[model samples]
Target: MARQTQALARICDVISRHAQEGRAPTALPRVRLERVSALTPPAGETLGPSVSLVVQGTVRTVLCEKTSYYGAGEFVVASVGLPVTCAVTGANKVQPYLAISISLQPAIVSEMLLAAPAPRQTTVSSVAQALATGIADPDLLDVVERLTRLLDRPADAAGLQPLYERELLWRLITGKHGQTVRQIGLPDSHLSQLSHAISWIRTHYDQPFSVEELAARASMSVTSFHRHFRAITQMTPLQYQKHLRLHEARTRLLAHADDVAGVGYAVGYGSPSQFSREYRRMFGAPPRNDAAHLRETSAT
Candidate 1:
């Protein structure tokens, strides 16, 4: 616990020096630091396979119906890409929120799986299931502080970052968050197979298909697929696809469109009325109003 406190202090100091407001990209790929000076409204975004460590303040992320909160000394891991609504809930002008994130790579995790001990579980339940946040232990916290210190010495990081990256991943598997990290690494695990199906759906979202087709793609029966898919994602396959479509449509609306009907069609919504209704449901406004608000925010 002493070491954890010390590490958090060091991490907070480094982040204060290196991270400006909002997300700051680090010298290493897939690593980022975030600083928030004020609480913000809830916003939806997609998070890739990664781990987020909150060194200060707090953030609330809602995935489907479940709301997970992460604060100082806590970390959240996402095994697969997920659409989530998040807000910076506990920051003020006086004390800002600070966080660091490391993107998880499947290839690296796969390699670690061969050497690391398997997660504790029954043979019937060997697959590592979906997990989110875990309180950081002293050892894991210590290694993370060392990893962040690399940002302090940029030249050495070029050669040393790979080593630290591997160590970080290994520790994650053996750490309190091991179960979730393990699921993401094992290529043959149920979560990985579901990830494949989700990937297929995301890439082909504009197209149509039934649950049976997606289930077959994942080599699972429809019932089994639905159960596990919903278990991990907190949404059914159709709901997931709808989110993808709506998110994509919203992105286009915010950035590239003057025609709401065109944006709707392009994102696979066949009917304009249906698109507007769903758009209102998701964004709390009609397409034009939301788009205008987003553009105005971006400009200012």
Candidate 2:
């Protein structure tokens, strides 16, 4: 535990130097650092395949009815694209929220899986199935530290960063969430199959889709598709579409607060009343009120 603590402190130092107020992109590709000095509002967004390591404060992420809380020394792995609401629940000026994220590449994961040894049987149930969190073991922490340090060496980062990233993925593939990371590389895996339908939903979220249509897209029967979709995403296909719609609507409203009804219609809500109702149900406030609140918060 002492070693882990020291490693976490080192990581915090590195991130604090490089990360600005919001998400700060690093010299390395697909790696970013985040520093937040205050608690953030619950905001909805879609996360692609990636790993998020928290080095300072706690984060609350909600996927449908399931909620996960992970703090310093813990990491969250997202196996596929998921629509989620996330907030930095623990943060302050003294010890702000600090995190490092690396986007996972299926090609690299697939290569590592091919050369990796056969798996051993285990009885570890995933935390949230698709979106799972695990304690970052010593080796994982070491890899993260090494990756963060590379930010200082722009020349070496281009060459050595890939190797370190592979090692980092290896750690995850062998750690508690191995199965979650492993599924991301498997072409025929359930997660990959669901990704196709998920991709479709993301692109055509504003359009109406039937369960059978999504099922056929994923090359599964209606029953199997619905079951796996819910299991992986914690939401039915329809519900997922609704989430994507609401999130997109919120994004639009933030930019054009006065275009509440137009934004709702653009996001596929035909009636302003229905849009306001559903928007209020998902977010705590109605469309216009929520937009005004978000604008006020952003200004300050």
Candidate 3:
């Protein structure tokens, strides 16, 4: 217990320094260690395929209507593509919220699984669609500490980081989150199938497709595909598409200040009114108003 606490403290120190300087950490894969001094409310949308660890504060993340909370000594794993709203819950100047995010490589995790022997009772089967899981084990924390320490040894990172990364994956697979990790590597599992479907949708979100076609692409019957899609994402295929479309539209408007109709068309909305309605429903405001408000706030 003492060692875990000490390691967490050291992590917090590292993140605090990075946040204070507002500089990205010089590490492989570009790790972002952050320390937020004020509590923040969740808003907007962002893509997260990263693992987030909280060393000194609490955070809540919402994805597709599913909410998850994590705090000091705990971590959250996002296994698949997701749009989420995240915020710090408990932080201040004296005890800032510390976080470290490491992006996941599905290829690496899959490689490790293939090269290693399977653990007992760990079948390569799909369990849940959501990849997010809470982890709070001492062994896992120790591995994370070692991974973080690699930042100090710039010379050794090239050769040793891969080994540490594999160790981290192995720990996750053998830890409480093993079930979800297992599903990601199994090519024929339902989660993997849905993941493939999701990748397709993301690549072609501006185009429309029939449910039958998507189900066929996923290699599942229409009924089964719909059921599993909702079970994992908490939204039907159409609903998921709508979310993706609106989110991307918002990005376009914010990044370029594009006209409402143009942005709508760019993201596949045929009618301006239809796009406005969906945008209002998903973001609680019309596209133009939301974009203007965001710009105004950012400028301030």
| Per-candidate local distance difference test | 0.82, 0.88, 0.74
Which rank order by lDDT, best down to worst?
2, 1, 3
| Candidate number of the best TM-score | 2
Higher-ranked by TM-score: 1 or 3: 1
What residue runs in model 3 are displaced by over 4 Å at the alpha carbon? 19-26, 34-49, 90-96, 114-126, 256-258
Best by lDDT: 2
Q: Give one digit per residue, the lDDT tens place, for model 3 in 1-300.
A: 787788888777656655552225555664667777767634545444556688888888777777778888888776677666676788777998887777767778788788656655633234564665675677778777777877676788888878877888888777777766666667776878888788888878899999999898899999999988887677788878887888788778887665999999999999999999988876778888888877775554
TM-score of 3: 0.85
Candidate 1 runs further than 4 Å off: 92-94, 122-128, 256-258, 296-300
lDDT of 2 at 78: 89
Clash numbers, per candidate: 0, 0, 0
Question: Model 1, clash count?
Answer: 0
In the order shown, the candidates' Cα RMSDs to the true structure are 2.6, 1.8, 3.2
lDDT of 1 by residue, 193-219 (tens): 898798988888878888998999999
